[model samples]
Target: ESPNDHINSHSINNSINVISDDDVAMEDVIDADDSAAKHEQIIVKWICQRCTLVNSEHSDRCDVCSSPR
Candidate 1:
C-alpha cells in the first residue's frame, strides 16, 4: 500500500465518439408529412350563394337550392 499500489486495472468499454460542428446540417432533417397531403386527391366543396348551402364541388348545381354554378 505505497505510491505504486495496484488494484488489477482493466478496460471497461470502447472509446467515446464526438461529433464536430460540420458533421450535421439543418436541411438534412426535412419533414415528410406534407408530401402525403400534397399527393392526396382532395375534393373542393363549394357553398351555394343562393341558399347558403354546402355542396360538393363535383356537382355543377347546388343540391339544396338547385342554383347553377
Candidate 2:
C-alpha cells in the first residue's frame, strides 16, 4: 500500500478503537446506574410500627399485622 493509504488506515483503526472503548465505558455507566437503582429499591423498606415487620415500599400496610404505614 502507499504511505498515505497506510497512514489513513492506521488513523481509521485508532478511531474504531476509541469508539469501542467509549461504548464499553457507556455500558459500565449504565450498569452502575442499574446497580444504584437496585440498591435504592432495597433500601426503601419501611418498618411496621405495630408488628415491627420490615415491609417493602410498595406495601401500604404491615405485612404481618395489617397496620397502616
TM-score of each: 0.37, 0.39
Q: What is the Cα-based TM-score of model 2?
A: 0.39
Local distance difference test, candidate 2: 0.48
lDDT of 2 by residue, 1-69 (tens): 677865533244212111122112111221332333321111356777777676767889888899988
In candidate 1, what are the lDDT values of residues 1-69, reduced to their tens digit? 775555222322222232223222122221243322222223356667788666666778989879986
**Each model's RMSD to truth, in Å?**
22.4, 17.2
Give the local distance difference test score of model 1: 0.48
Clashes of each: 0, 0
Clashing pairs in 2: none
Which window of ten consecutive residues has the lowest lDDT sum in model 1? 22-31
